[model samples]
Target: MISDGVSVEALTQWQEATVGSLLSQALNRWPDRAAIRWPTPTGLKTLTWKQVWDSAASGAAQLRADDPTPIAIFAPNSEGWYLSLWAVALSGRPLVPINPALTEREVRAILMDSGASIVLAARDYRGRNLLEAVARLNIVDIQHLWDVDDWISATQSATGAIGAVAPQSTFVIQYTSGTTGTPKGVMLAHRACVNAASTLIATLEPGDDETCCSPSALHHVGALIAHALALARIGATYVMMNEFSAQGFVEAAASSRATILAGVPTMYSRVLDDPSFADVKLPDVRVLMLGGASIPVTLVSRLESHFGARVAVMYGQSEAPVITATRLDDPAWMKAHTVGRALPHREIQILGVATRSPADVGQIGEICVRTPVRMVGYLNLPDATSKAIDDEGWLHTGDLGALDVEGRLYFHGRLREMIVRGGENIYAREVEEVIESHPRVAEVAVVGLPDSDWGEIVAAAVVPRTGATVSADELSAWVERHLARYKRPTSWRFVDELPMTASGKPKKFAIVEWFGAIDGN
Candidate 1:
């Protein structure tokens, strides 16, 4: 076993078993430990490992009797939601969890692509009746396991060979947002899931006695399996939060007695904004993780002082999601400036965009990754999949970054979002990072807008810090001091707030409506 912390020999014992096998073992091991939690108007709801397993087993038995294939979950984050994931795994069937906030059209696209035989629609997820809604769509065969209780006992009589399902079998089909064109279903095999989980668990080094909390979505690997499942690998008690709220998080962490509560940059901002957390007792909390997007140095400094020596910064994506993460002991210079080195069994190479060769120290390039945990390409799109995953199996992550000699990577931005100002390429994330560091900026988003003179001009949207003066010129000058001339934003707008998805990444396309309404141009 590699000595990181969560060394369970999962790779050797159940390496060939399905995800359900892992879930089953985890549940059996900690039948009394709390596994999931959700929010209520008045308080929070929680589930123990045994209760979750029993519920999932019932769901799986129902699913197997119905179709013995993929089951799609069109819902939000909750205890039932997580139970559905385990249930699908237990049945040795693929599970599809769609974002609840997506439009009808977007939702339809996912349904069509997955070819799901059943959709698990229960009531009270963010107050939507997903069951009736999908039946209204009348797209594919859909069924509510809740609606059929008899199937559970009937199928359990024949729950044979399921626990032994091979790990290399397709475990999940998560669709990437179709921003570039159409959404592609990423098929992750059982082996891939196990490897990813093992690597992440080893990296975190959670103690067996640790209690963990994840407030992010489970559909996203960064939160789903990365932090939550990783902690669970070593028998750490895990508490789930339905949605992110500053007061709710602090209360839940204290309530569940969680030692590690994972958060994104936005989560940290909310806690800082929460008045109740200022004087609240947070003794159980130890590690505060920041990921999904880069953390501002100013925010880091403020959070470090406020949270007291446990804030860890990380940078990740859907592809190779656990690329680099900071350790609590990292020095200020490394912690503030870079995404830490790769987790165990993972390797990264920053190749110059033009050369496709290893970039010189501090030179930016397209970040490519080779990990045993990598997904089994985008489903059914062979040509598109071929372009992304090469013959050598390296996933071309389409994200740009610079590698320091110490092997830490500083993220630049998405390859498609790069701005070309009079033929000079500029990474918007690099510029936005600088803008976000300004004292008066609460949040910021940088994008390239059409400009007749320069082809594509760097435009930014800034959310001013609580009742503070923030001018376009001042922001532009701040970026200029930190970035090259062409990398600075040329045009900008200051707003009361910026639009974001539940995951806290700025929805760049959605901002058009808000920005257009504000400027009337």
Candidate 2:
């Protein structure tokens, strides 16, 4: 076990020290400093540390007045949802954040499974009225928390339940996509939350003036909890966009004067593709953190040109809080490719025959990690939870990689056959699902093949759905705009039928061999 030498996590009373408490301390220390900001069609709104705390306290008080633990929140990225996240933790209540992009049916499943009592959703999102969907959740109180008027009224009511909550208390219930079956909710305990935040803050060394804007899904650990709270803990500024829009992101970075920005590869791809990038002067952006999918080498140069070569290509996952991150201080070449070094408090041991250990120099194997920030367990999935976190407490990351003699980490390949096209993860089954949704699509399988430009491009093979005439171009354009662009298949192939076993799963590798490529175009 590595000693952190007295920091955020690993301290005894951590569970009681809620993310709310961390915000409160920031508020007291820098009462006037801007804690969070977002640009609206009308204007930009900034929240001070104190203001964020009080709003959270108001939310905690309101939710605690009714339920003692685990309040629910469902909304696109917004200040209201962020406040409620803090409020729930402060009142010693766990927060359950559901995916806003999920269809109503999908949304309902998570709410019911997590047992979230109070649900806070937006009344309006991009002019789409989703309150009806929130209403259907049948949660205890389907309050529109983003109602600026309602939130302001609630915060000013002197209803904040002022108290200290332990860090070990349940803070949030994060649900993993149940592709194999039903999605399981992961209850992140307070100690784990503090440990995750402290691990990142101490290693990343977020400065007091540092500002971070992330396009990751808010319900995921990267945004709602890990990156968001970690920013507050370090007294840095936080910024959110209602949704990830390429043009909107460029504007937000400049509008908020954010110094630090983290986003998946797809988010940056559009920015790079735009001819206007040369004109969109995001001058204040000092550090750029890249993750989710493989970072494009082209992007490294573009980012260097844009941000003065201060880029960090990081590798992370929801299961393990940020495991590796590079810095602006590292060699520019290393910053462009390597996933940097293992986090300060983490231990890495490559598992397999050729992997003699880090001292072996050129070794390749799965990346197993032991850290203070890992989650307690996945909700209602004991067998899976046990498999994920071994008895030794080392997290067996599915990614394959190697450590050089210089102690830098280099990503090799994946143990699991998951597709990452433009930073949006396209689970084979998930894409194979949508392709089969077409009326003409009879059978289909999806895979991530190599691409020189966008890293891995999404490709698909389909067997027309029984005499239905669905042309490749039409299907490509159809699926393109339907799903998130990153998940959309760039290429497609129509076949007589798909190859499957007696149990029925696309022999993805074999399909790749037969079809040559999965192309929709």
Candidate 3:
């Protein structure tokens, strides 16, 4: 029946079902409600639930006769993105959403690896033209290349049998954010999507008319599954932003009177840094759901003080959406320190070095989770799937963390991201937290560089605050005072900006590459 905090009405309203069925229910319940709203060239465009459904149905009818090979969607956040997603699911085929920021080479790799037979993409976004991007791809598996406009066209008269997708069938193959290495396609079932959305909606309990402003990309978990689908579950209005800017987000929320706002820590930092943010007043704002990367405590404090909105820090990987989130009613300390206890009917465990046994309370270990919402596995990689999800069905997350006596999870850095300096383990997040605390440092990333003597040396890449400057030596001294001598950065580089994945996580590999290039190594 879901968690105690969730009302009985919500529990019954949210059952495990195919995403196609859920969309149908939403259309029947809120036919005339404003379902999707985004800015266009001439002006803003708003689509009702019925319009969205009818458009998707037309696309589904056309695709129902084709083979179920996964379709690759390469476009920015737009109404066309959602329409293609819903249409593919209704046709009983998996849809793979690719980040528009990926290089042509990277996109080619994913296309070849997934063996996608169909591609739906926009002509252009910002300056990057998708038509040119597709021309650069050397792969031959793609049987059809439908423009985003034509794929979601409401005027198409194609009519055919729309197959019913089983709840256990895969709906989307969401690729992992390639911060450390090449991205892998994660297979997510329809039931998993439904359960994850319901769990999040039930936990937040947003009103039926709750208006949500989402600045994150539609391809990512935060926007696609958690924010968009969750809002639709409650028949809420969704205010979509194609591209995120501090000024745009502030104005959109203020204009729409959005009650909920969601984004990554970097996005929120940009908002706070923007001078125009001071002029915007969002009295209807109730909560700011922060996810993607480790959040700074200072950011949370500033949001609460300035906006008078509760900040909920959410933690999850692409494999398992919404594993843990600090509830809005939780105390300030809990919200700041830990990603709250497991959601309803979900189990989380911390395994020690042994990897088989649970760690003692307050002991740091690898975080493993078992939930119905867990992904099926990585696409076309059975060995990788076996390694990720064990025989016992527990998804072994590479993240290291500790669980308190009360079952709250305290996240460390990724197990692979640990910088081993002369046999001593230094978590990147631990050192990053120290450097980011500096007044002049707006953002920082800590990584390990290969060294002949130390085996691996710690390095830091710093992004200065706008109109602020600090020398590398100054930052070194700041860290030296706060952290141990070994934990301090042995090398530092100041950059205008850090390379980031679409989800806003710093690409540490890219930072290391840039540092190496600068050093002429």
TM-score of each: 0.90, 0.74, 0.95
Quote the lDDT for 95 in model 3: 82
Q: Indicate the TM-score of model 2.
A: 0.74
lDDT of 1 at 390: 79
Best by TM-score: 3
Clashes of each: 2, 20, 0
> Cα deviation of 197 in candidate 1 (Å)?
2.1
What local distance difference test score does each model get?
Answer: 0.70, 0.66, 0.82
Error of 3 at 382 (Å): 1.1
Candidate 3 at residue 105, lDDT?
83
Model 2 stretches astray by more than 4 angstroms: 1-16, 126-128, 137-152, 158-160, 177-182, 202-205, 353-361, 418-521
TM-score of 3: 0.95
Worst 10 residues of 2 by lDDT: 1-10
Cα lDDT tens digits for candidate 2, 1-521: 12113343343223435676677778777788888888888867899888887777676666666656455666677777777677767778777877666678887777667666666676776665566676765665343334522553565675644666776666778775432234567777776776567656555544447778766666776666546777776677888777777778888888788888877655675576566675775778877777655444456666777666377666666566667877657866676557888765677777763343332555666778887666667776789888878888888876666688766877653555567666655555445545655555545667677787877877787765333578878887777756877888777777775553211234556666665633342
- Prediction 2 global C-alpha lDDT: 0.66
